[model samples]
Target: MATTGGARPYRPTLRAMSVVTFNVSGVEPVQGTFDDLGTPLHEVTFVVFDLETTGGSAREHAITEIGAVKVRGGERLGELATLVDPGTPIPPFITVLTGITDAMVTAAPKIASVLPTFLEFIRGAVLVAHNAPFDVGFLKAACAELGYPPPANPVVDTADLARRMLTRDETPDCKLATLARVFRTPNQPCHRALADARATVDVLHALLERAGAFGVHTLEELTAFARAPSPQQQRKRHLAEAVPRAPGVYVFEDARGEPLYVGKSANLRNRVRSYFTAAETRPRIREMIGIAERVRPIVCATALEAEVRELRLIAAAKPRYNRRSRFPERVVWLKLTDEPFPRLAIVREVKDDGCAYLGPFGGTRAADDARTAIHEAVPLRRCSERIGVRTRRPACALAGLGRCGAPCEGRETPEAYARHVTAARRAMTEDAGIVYAAVKARMDRLAAEQRYEEAAVDRDRLAVFVRVAARMQRLAALTRIPQLVAAAPGADGGWDVHVIRHGRLAAAGVMPRGAHPVPYVEALVATAETVVPGPGPTPAASAEETECILRWLETPGVRLAQVDGSWSLPVNGAGRLLARIELAYQGRDERPAREGRPLR
Candidate 1:
């Protein structure tokens, strides 16, 4: 090897060293395909385990020892054991049972350094412990803090196996000691994990033989039978029984009565009960049970109408316990200024003005999104400045950028920019159909000029318009509102007119009983009969008729349509006038009306 200035070049050595991860168990096969003692016992592919703990209860104790034996097809292959010095005072009761004093394990390695080796040894084996969950739960809790996924392998609880095999009369309470005594298995110092594990293994051998005779052979069957009645299930059953069955929304409360969960059903009782008995579990439901102290139900109308009422209540209450619904209310409006050069601004909140307002969007975000969109579509000067941009000697930054069209600098004519702004506003607020057509026209021109890249951009913009149009079409499919025309009752006095809109029965309306029971769809259809559709609403309808139609459409169930599609009206003087102008519309574009405020 070449040497540097004063340092010798490093030489690497080629040496292979085999390192075994860990010994699985102390039992070793000394006979033909089996351990010298156990039987035609095929090596039981299991993680035979024991845990030395500071106390008896798994909940409040820490493990102080661990040991295991790995067996495959009834043949013991390896052994591993460790005395963990649990960093806690070992109780006198535990000390007497296991004979493992705190002093004995003081020199042993800490759990942090030993667990990795232990896990490696048991990697492919089904964990087997006497009363497995107690040990397993403690081990898993330890494992969790280390970011380990809890063992996915089945855990075979030997305690359960012993009880199933032993005669009830001979041994009713199958304690490890009792079973050890009955089976003649030697009792090593009980709490010493390794010695106890050895005793458990002996008991396991006998139980396997007993279980095999009764045809309980597979690992799956063994584990399933073991995990039947955990304390968690009993708790869930108690909760389910407490919820009342009724027509209402059930609120699951934590100890504080702060709603942790809210759910509604036709049969409150049945729905609440379903959570307890169901085999398939929802993690959230399990979480609720962990903290829940009480269940409360608030009665409501029919189940069919629960969703609507639920939304109203949730919106009003803004409950911390209830998760917010994904679909939120949006409210928006189009603002038309009273200035000489009128500017339209899409706003989340509408201002009182002589000009029109379009909507209260279903949600604040939706309305804000709409505002951003309209602003981008129409880059008109919506600033507080009263003077025309072109009239100024020094143009603002907007004019400096091409966005202003240099009208402020007088490079572009005021009339031309105004025309463009008008077109842009129309495309944004009233309807996007105009914007789509304009973009389509520009795209055609670009393609004709062989500007493919520019044409592609236009194509993308057109796609956006198509998407918006499709969404609008879908919205229209779900909602149908016709112009409302006031009507008289039929001869029989039973209401017969078709209601095109949902009308509230105000005290001023007919039916002195003050009942606004049924909404009048006929009113909406009759109102649509007044507007003649072409470029816009007709001059005749624009006078007083337009106001009537707009007012009626502004009602809850009625929405204003830019174009009147179709309608049916009675043949009265007002109806006759409406029929005549049903298709007539003013060529001028009307600004969208301003609703009260954005739907927050």
Candidate 2:
């Protein structure tokens, strides 16, 4: 389907193959799970075909001729060429181009009879064509109309294959006639079906030889070998061959073994191999694949452990390819200012000065949102200036509006303001019932008055406040414990046991059904890594790691095996309040949808 173009004939030389990384870094994850390249190229049967249609559109056109050649290992097994009698008269322009006059095809076989034969010939063999979509589209459209199932054979485009190796410096463009001339095939195209297909066969063989230098010798590799991946990506694909099909982390590195990217997946082999496939469309990932010289896989006992390891590795390496979670220390915390008249402050550091902290928020906006919500519930001062017992300043508009106690003006006593501080502190660390109640009352009053927008505004503030408070309290409880052992039911009734030290995953294993948990738990704890506790809420590990541990422990059906200290929240805690706020939000969100209004 290619027209002749003025260009110089040339052949391209591929870069020489280099050393590849085929061995995995850590222990084998799971036996017999690694993917192997299927079916070598020379062993595959390819049906190279071409078609001459009456028009450009597959829906509007009819096939005038079908020509194909079946080949294996550079030997032609058979050739199929037939004039298809389109029921409709052939267009004048098409007749002039293909030289197939109306009288010549007046008694030829109809497409309905020819389709069954064509489908049978291409069955179980890879189909090859130039600009394949045009030819394959017509064949598939005919099959759909004639009650015949579409052929399932894989397709390869010599046009695309030529583009992979030939650049503009060597060839002006990728066209069937151009390639046929460049490769100097025995058969030449003259707008005839059989001749063009035969010309494409030689072009394919030359392209395959070029592809062989890139390590694309298998049918699977050829399909994924679209643009002929960079020499590194094509060669480094073997690094994923030895990985296990289990939950773990994978690190891509440069030739010097410097980390380029760190990621985790429930199945390590499948995820790592995706990098070398056409399915990975991210431009940055493709670039990383091009630079990657090796892949280091670390298999974990559980998915949660894999996730925790990914975060830790990303934070440690600060890989340029990863866009998030590289600098956990940059997170902000909402600290209750330790003073005579305390106020909520969004600070970036966590100190051991005995001040109540509420977060490790990823951004200042989230910390500020939660702070504003808490201020809506409690009459805490919002001034940036520090205030002590002896300090004095004029009352602001908030104090005049009765929103604050005006401790700066000495209009409110420290003793009297201490009560409000106590309530705010309790909301931050232990319970949020008072904060949730105060906000809910205001929201309900606003809703009853038909001020839904105002009510939603209050709801937004309360949402962030309750969620942060609940999350921080959960993290604090677990991080305070010196050691904890827990188990969750795994597949086939096995138990995924974990030893957590100060909210960090120290050791983990899978305990078979009917196995003694106490002995297994004891052994795991004994072998667990040592963690020297730090100060503040997160003592041994990061706040993110503590949150991960909390989520694993809170999963349904998970049972506690052992604990070194008490790990409990207040009876009236933020967990219940967080659930109520979530339910209220769900209803508010659904109301707009049911009423046909746009939802936020």
Candidate 3:
């Protein structure tokens, strides 16, 4: 069915999987339907390692020894143990503790040379360490000094895992020595690198065995479990039990029945479950979960529907936890005032009063910058006061400066001023080549005079003008089409069809596998909402909604079934102008005194 502004569409709310089951162990049984939970632990390769350094601080010390054991599926693939030359004398106390004298590592290779070999040994594996901060920090510091990018591998700290899983009955402390004794592995730690690393691997297996009872089998679960989630999160894990494992928007409503937050995901169950797990690291979400009393899932047939619905829901509800897409009114527009001596004006609202508009700019600053660029290009008056055709007033200093034609004092006739208004209107909508040329030439003039900073400001303003003009014109083209029928390839050998009228989503549905799309398209178009054209580019829909439709149309596999109008931009339009302006911006920062300016 069709939905207008703030209206609900008729779609399936997945309720078939809402039946709850009891688990004696008090753990929510892990479901296979949650596909976004990352790689399984057994399928992941792990490099369990330990490092011995000269000091605790990575910034102030050097690594003395490195030891690693690479394992997958309880089988050891390889081992790396190497001594590194500290490049300084070993302290007497350290030599006595680890039983390594200064002469012991004299023949060893330097850290810079050995780092590459160690990195290759642990390539494409999860790094496990006793206290990861001490080991990983030193490796990162060394990589920075040598001008190599830091390793992009996932890390698991056995110390933090042990703290979250075991109690005083299991072990009094989370230290490697205590865990090694509790697990009673073959290897014992005696201040040696390889032995301690081997002991850590044994403790890691023991912790995993304990975690299995709590449904922590995946790597994503393992990392989140290490964060020691709050008690409230555990108690509220049942809220996600009724959520369908489908693409949709989920609202977290407080006890007062008001939405606390709104979010959308391809897999609703998996994403909502993550909020109660340690995987959700946002503090605001954590707070929202505490106040939320129920999970309301609105399942959709496709992710695009979920996205559009989420935007509208957030805008209507103004949920406290959601910071974006809530206040469309805050966006300002730059419209040419509909007057005898028309000028560019920043307006909070768009009206169908036969005026040209350039925006729905993000803020006043952007609209103001676009206004300045238009004035620079078109020689429009800058005063805020209104001027009449018959009334005579004193001209401002701008007339003497030759920036204005002195229309206020009748020095410039109404017919003459109308020409500038026409140019300004053209710059805002149909074509932007004139504005681009004028701004670029002025920027070039500034750069030639060694005024590089001032020229850069002009470059930024021109960029703003180009981007907004292109966006508004593109939206204008879309909104002018009375009705558009399009289809995007669905994931399951089907077609996701949409009916858009005046750039607003009128109706949407998905055709099943091997089903004919012609009937589906015909039925949707017949049942689609009727949208009357409003003034300006975005009529029935917000500028954001029209842009969303434009993006969906541009996606790779979309096919246009029908369009009411030409539904195309001018051959020479803002798109081409934006490209040339971007090139000038690229060279805007360079030295102006060197030679040729970038505007040409």
Candidate 4:
């Protein structure tokens, strides 16, 4: 069985028809099976459906009109059209586009009156429409609201059909009007139900001839062929539909349901959907799409919040697909402790307390260029000995290159040299005052010397530093010292925490951050330590609360630790990551460490 357009071939209610054979008496029921017709349909079966919509998007928009025509064996059926009152004011744009005005629908039968008959007529037919999915989605939504199950029919877009059918043609256009013109079918008034329905029929006739030449007369074969994108693309498409329009970070998971990719964006919905869009055919996206099983997202307030969240998820999940870069020359940092020949190092890894990292830049080359710019602006030692904390004599190798001024050889005092280092650190991390001060000072000096070019360069650097540094410190409050707290801000301006150990609850409590943790800690930690006589009530949590727990429990270790001022927990098992992290983070400070160890 083959269906055209978007309709599926399903059981149908056969239309009653009368035949006369010169009978004067009442006619008897016709007795025959499908074979009695004596001929089988060889051409594609098209279930052409039409709709007048209140607007575009299926999610927010409603359908105002429906019309359909079933065609097979080059014969089109009589029109089956219905008018629907969308239950809301139809905009003027809709009225202009569809020519379905309010007064006309005021007396017309509503969708409910015609739905049963319409569905019965369309069953066992492949749905067809000029732009089929739009109509089908509305039909499905209407059916659901009417307490009727969806038709479960796959849609075939006639617009897509035309595109494929004439891919090589250099015609005027591919719009319905152009399609009609190409086939020399008379132009029908736009937006009228029966007229557009008839035009669609003409378009399908022209398309089928081209499609049949490629052995694609049946809808089933073409549908199967079109659905062959990697499983990743499919899952990504599914996730794109689910994400809300918000700013956030999205995590893409692998087939076994593990996080494989983590990314952030100011517009979470748009950014995540980009990976699933048709143009994402690059090798990296293809691979990510192949492995991705889920797209989970967390909303944030700003682009910087999104960036911080993205970095946190990447570090915590250690997604197998995103391997961190290993090149040392590409990493940029602020040498906060550098003094007496202070230097700005371009290195891959962050060394403890030696320097503060500011970027994993757009690319390795940008980072290298930034380092070059810094070195040009401020002379410093660039030798292995000084960087490694070894004694160095005379000037380092970079002295002859004008990058080092031999400050380590007592050409400049350590205190005087420390000012430059402070300036650089401020430019990278704090970003607020130092860059402006340096630029203004240098600009004033250049202007006094009448060197406008040099002054302009300093001003531009000042602007660049301001922008980049602003991004780095966007979530300053988020990356603060971790004070053990019982809960995060809840939707209702309250907090929640549950105390459980060995898969059972000993006590559950909630306390404000300003309140002392001693009593709550005592109760929660005791739950983890005390052996209960019998199994306690299982933890009762809403979906959102359960989700919060599951996310926290998934970190790498069982015990909790703070990473760069953010609260973190460790996990041993990959499969139990979500559950484990949840348990660890819930009442984290309250649970005293095992064997009399300190909670901190």
TM-score of each: 0.38, 0.60, 0.65, 0.38
Q: Which residue pairs in model 2 clash with each other?
A: none
Residues 1-600, model 1: lDDT tens digits: 111110222111213232233345865533332122232224247778888788765545677889887765544568899888666667888888778788987998877778888888888777888877788887886687567777776677778676545655777576777777777764443666777676677667667656555544455445544443323444666666655655568777778777667777868878876655434244346546556777777665333223334554565555554665422333344455655455655565444454544333444444344444444455566455564643655556776565556454567666776776676545543455544445546656766776755655544444433333333322232122232333334223432222222121111122223335344343334333232222111212111223233334444543222223433221221222222122222211121111111100
Alpha carbon lDDT of each predicted model: 0.52, 0.81, 0.81, 0.55
* Model 4 agreement with the true structure over 1-600: per-residue lDDT tens digits: 213331332222234333234444767655555444322234445677677878886655666877777777557655688787765567898888887888878777767877888788777776777766677788887787688989866666767666545643545456777777777664353876667777787676666555545545345555643344434565558767788787678888866778888887767788887776555544456667766777888876433345445655665687866665212234343333444455665554445444555554545555554454454455545554553234446776676665565665656666666666775665565444433444456667776787755665554444444433443343232223222223333223433444433222223344465666557666555554343322111112111222233344343432332123453221211122223223423553233222111111
Compared with the true structure, what per-residue lDDT tens digits does model 2 show for residues 1-600?
111221222122324333234447765454331134466676779999999999987776789999999977667789999999977778899989999989989999999999889999988999999999899999888998799988889999888777666765777778887877777777788888998888888788778777766667678888887745544456678989988899999999999999999999989999998887656645568668878888999999888889899999999999999998889989898999898888899998888788888887888988888887788778999998888888888978999888899999888899999999998988888778777777778777777787776777777777787887777778878887888889999867999989898888899888889899878888888999998777667878888888888878888989998889999887777887866666665644224422211112
Instruction: Give the residue spans of candidate 2 off by over 4 A.
Output: 1-235, 244-247, 444-454, 489-495, 510-519, 587-600
Runs off by more than 4 Å, candidate 1: 1-247, 277-282, 326-347, 350-403, 406-425, 428-430, 438-600
> lDDT by residue for model 3 over 395-479, one digit each (tens)?
8899998989988888888899989999998888877888888888888788879886688788788889889889988998988
Tell me the spans in candidate 4 whose CA falls farther than 4 Å from its real position.
Answer: 1-45, 57-59, 152-154, 168-175, 187-189, 219-222, 225-476, 479-560, 563-600
Best by TM-score: 3
Residue 271's lDDT within candidate 2 is 95
Worst 10 residues of 1 by lDDT: 591-600
Decreasing TM-score order of the candidates = 3, 2, 4, 1
Comparing 1 and 2 on lDDT, the stronger one = 2
